[model samples]
Target: MTRVAVVQSCTGIDPAANADALTAALGRAADGGAAIAFTPEMTGLLDRDRARAAACIVGEDEDRVLATAREVAARHGLWVQIGSLALRAEDGARSVNRGFLIDGAGAIRARYDKLHLFDVDLPGGESWRESSSYLAGERAVVAETPAGRLGMTICYDLRFPDLYRALSDAGATILAVPAAFTVPTGEAHWHVLLRARAIEAGAWVIAAAQSGRHADGRTTYGRSLVVDPWGEVVLDMGEGEGVGFAEIDAARIDEVRARVPALRHRRPIPRVEIAA
Candidate 1:
């Protein structure tokens, strides 16, 4: 069983303060015998005020939060999966939700930009226009990690199963979904969607999420989870802010897939024709 840790945190507006919290979490994860640690979305900075967020949101090369994470990962000899960071886009006007997988030695193994943008007006008068401030990513990403071949996706991407299918078909053994989800939606679909994805892909699913209320006055549904290939909840850190650990049994993937063989059975669907 490969040990992994999930860091559930309530990020604030200050990037410096957020970095301090993350570093401390990494220390605890390492000390707890976790080989790799995963953190939620907006690990760097979570500010609804884009005007205020602009100052801290810089290019990936100059992102202080990413820099801090890399240094800490290397020092602790632990692999770290940053759920996603808000970074200034190439055009310099918009931003991108990007996640990174850092090796134990501090080398970046892969980067997955969030593909799905949340643009909706909910029933409770809650509204978000992510596409207005962020550009959508076009491609999917899968990379190597100490735990296994990791498939990467951000929060909203969890709602889209095609991305997960592509990742699993590409030989991903473990799926990483790092999210900062809203309270309402998280409560309604968090557990079910995660379990379904694990069952469909027949791969272990690990979601490290942001929990509690943030400095930006937004509350996230915090229930970081780990589901085995058989759709069993191995670990669920409910409504708290801290690091939780779980064991990913590599053999479980083989056992589940061998029985289901869903991936092998997948066939291309043809276009529909209408008869008048």
Candidate 2:
């Protein structure tokens, strides 16, 4: 059994505080015998103001959060997957929502930049244009780990099943979606979307999420979860700052795929036109 842990918590403008909270969470996970741990999106900072984000930017080589997380992972001898950090982009005008995977020895294994942007108008008069402050990533990433191949993605990417399918086809048996999904969307679509992805790909889904309200007054849906290939939610923590853990049998992945085989039966979707 591969024991995995997820953090369901809040974030703020203070990067140091966030790191401290994460370290404590990691300790809890380690005590529970988790071999792998993941945190929520914007694990470092959560300022909605674009200028503040730019001002707080740290280069990939010298990022404080990354450095601290590496040390923590090394100390615990566990695989650590940070949800997302605001790293300087190529143009230096904005940052990329990047997720970093660190091996048990604390070496950086892989990184994935978030591909989708969250641009929406909420029912409560909240408007977010994440693209304004982030550059969309063009590539999908899947990395090999001791447990299995992990497909990495950020918040908004959860809405796109195509990306998840591509990762599944590329031999990904586990998918990680680190998100700070807004309250409205999270309450309505979070579980459905996560379970659907797990069922469709016949892979385990581990989603770490931001819960409660942030310093910028942005509310996030906080039910971080781990779902089995059969769409069974192994663990779920609704609305709080806490750690959730589950032991996943990697061998069960093959059993589910062999039993259902939905991935092999997918027919190519055809385009259609309608008269105006």
Candidate 3:
């Protein structure tokens, strides 16, 4: 069994302060004997104001939060997933919401940019145009680590099942879905969606989340979760800022798949001709 830690934090507008908070959380996870640590989306900073967020964003090489995470991973000898950092894009008009998978040696093993953008206008008059300031990624990423092969995704990607299916087909046993989900949608759909993904893919799903009200006055749902392949929630950090730990057993994936075999039984649907 590989032990993993998931961090739930209320990130503010300040990148430096966010890094400090994440570093401290990593320390706690390390003390708990976790082999890998996962952080929430926008781990560096969370600001709704596009201009202010752009001003605060920096290149990956200059991001203090990313640097701190690397250092912490190396110090603890733990694999770290820096869940999504908003970095200044090469185009200059927008930023990239990128996730990094780092080895215990502090070397970056894989990078996955967020493919889906949240562009919803909510019922409470809250509006988000994430695509306006963030470019969408074109590819999916799966990386090999000590614990298992992990498929990386962020935030809005959770709503897309095809992505998860593709990852599972590509040999990913675990899926990392780090999110900064809005409270309203999260309350209604978060748990069900995550559990559905795990059950459909026959994979372990770990979701570290952002919680509470942030500096930009945005509120997020705070249930960081670890769901087993059987659709059971092994761990749930409910409505608070803290760290949660869970064990990932590779055999559990096989056990679940052997019983159902849904993946192997999948067949393409035939197109039907209708009278016009």
Candidate 4:
């Protein structure tokens, strides 16, 4: 069994303050004997004002949050998966929502850009045009981690089950979902989708989420959770902002897969044709 920590935070506009929040959470996770720590999306900065956020959003090389996480990971000898950081794209066009997997030695093992951008207009006039500011990634990414092989996805990506299926086919034993989910959607679909993905893949699903009121005056549904391969809820952090620990049993994967080999049973379906 691998011990992992999920960090729930209400990030602010200032990178420095966000860094402090992450640092404190990481320290707590390390002290509690977590081999790896997972944090919510936009862990560094969560300012809604695009103009104000632009000042803090820089390329990955110059990102303060990335630097801070690397330093902390090295100092504590703990692997850290930063959910997602809003970064200035190299092309100088739209930014990218990127996630980083850092080893215990502070080396970046893999990076995944968010494949799905949130471009939705909700019922309450809460509209988001993520594509206007962020470019979506083209590929699925999976990498080795302390818990198991991790498949990375940001908030909106959770709505697409095919991504998880692809990841499972690619041999991912664990799925990492880092999110800054709104209260309504999180309340309605967050838990259900996570559990479904876990069961479908016969893998572990660990989600770290942002919660409570933020500096930018946005409220997030904070219920950072860990679901096992059997679709069992292992841990739910509720709306509390702190480090929560969960035990990941790698054997659960084998046991679950052995019982119901859904991944192996997958079959590609032909394109749908509508009746004339």
Candidate 5:
């Protein structure tokens, strides 16, 4: 069994402050004997203002949050997953929501950019046009890690099951879905969706999330979860910010799949024509 830590924290407009919070959280997770630590989305900055966020965004090499995380990971001898960092885009007009998997030696093992942007107009005047200021990623990422074959995804990608299926097909045993979800949607669909993903893929799902109101008045639903292969929620950090840990047993995947065999039972969809 691999002990993994999920960090639920409130991020604000300041990158330095966010980095500090994450560093402390990493230390706590290490103290708890966790081998891998996962942080929430937008771990660097959470400002809504496009200009201010853009100004605060820096290249991955120059990002204070990433640098701090690397240092902390090295110090603790821990594998750190920075859920998603807002980095300055090469085009200079937008930013990239990027997730990094750092090894115990503080070297980046893999990176995944968020593919599906959260572009929606919600009720109560809540609107987000993420595509306007964030470029969508074109590829999915699955990395080999000490815990298991890890599939990396971010906030909005949870809505897409095909991505998870693709990752599962690529030999992923653990799926990391670090998010900054809105309260309404999170309240209604978060647990259900995460559990469904775990059952369908027959893989462990680790979701570290952002919670509470941010500096820009936007609130996030906190309930970072670790779902087992049988769709059981092993851990849930309810409605607050902190670290949650769970043990992931690789044998659970084999046990669940041996019973259900759903993945092997999958067949290609057949085309049907409509007759008028």
Candidate 6:
């Protein structure tokens, strides 16, 4: 069994503070014998203003958060998945939600960008149009790890089952859905949607999430979890910032697949009528 640690955190405007919290959490995970550690989306910083976020973008080579995360992974001899960091885009006005997977030796193994943009209207006048400030990623990524083949994804991507399905088809035994989900949506759809993805894909799901209020006044859901292939909640931290750990036995994938054979049973979709 390979053990993975998920870090639940509240991000503010300070980059140093965020990294400090992450480093301390990493130490705790190391002490717990975790082979891999995952952090929430926007692990480095979280801001609400589009113009301010755009102005703070750092180049990939110069990103402090990624560099520090790589060093941490190397020092602990564990794989580290740093959730989406705001990256400088070509337009010089927008950022990308980028996920990185670093090896035990501090080398980058794979990276995935968040493809979906959270542009919606919620109850109580809550509205988020992520596309206004961010550009969506077009590719899917999966990396080989000691635990198994691990898939990568960021916040808002969790709502799209097709992405998870594609990741599973690409040999992802463990799906990482790191998110900074809002409280309203999270309370209603978080657990059920996460469990559904695990069950449908027959893969272990590790979701490290943002929690509490941010410096920008946005609130996150913060129930970081590790679910088994059987859709069992192995580790759950409810509504707070901390670290959660779970042992993932890769054999469970085969066991679940053999029992249901859902992947093999999939059929082509038939044409349906649509209103024009």
Residue-level lDDT tens digits of model 1 in 160-252: 999999999998999999998899999899999999999999999999999998899899999999999999999999997999999999999
* Model 1 vs. true fold: TM: 0.98
Error of 3 at 110 (Å): 0.5
**TM-score for all predictions?**
0.98, 0.95, 0.97, 0.98, 0.98, 0.95
- The regions of model 3 sitting more than 4 angstroms off are 269-276
Query: What is candidate 4's lDDT per residue for 1-276, written digit by digit as tens?
Result: 999999999999999989988889999999999999999999998988999998989998999889999999999999999999999998987799999999999999999999989988887889888888999998999999989999999999999999999999999999999999998899899999999999999999999999999989889999999999999999999996989999999999999999998788899978999999
TM-score of 4: 0.98
- What's the true lDDT of residue 214 in model 3? 89
Candidate 5 lDDT, 5-101, residue by residue in tens? 9999999999889888988999999999999999999998998998778788989889999999999999999999999999987777678999999
lDDT, candidate 4, equals: 0.94
Candidate 5: the clashing residue pairs are none
Extract clashing residue pairs from model 2.
none
lDDT comparison, 2 vs 5, better candidate: 5
CA displacement after TM-score superposition, residue 250 of candidate 2 (Å): 1.4
The candidate 3 region of ten consecutive residues with least summed lDDT is 266-275
Cα RMSDs, all models: 1.0, 1.6, 1.1, 0.9, 1.0, 1.7
In angstroms, the error of model 3 at 253 is: 0.5
lDDT of 3 by residue, 189-224 (tens): 999999999999999999999999889998999999
Please tell me which model should have the higher lDDT, number 5 or number 6.
Answer: 5
Which runs in model 5 stand beyond 4 Å of their true positions? none
Better of 3 and 6 by TM-score: 3
| Residue range 1-276, candidate 2, lDDT tens digits | 888889887998877888788888988888888999989998988888767666777878767788888988999998899999998986776789999999889899999999999998888798998888788999999998766899998988999999998999898999999999888898899999999999999999999999998887788889999999999998989998999888889988989999999988987778887869
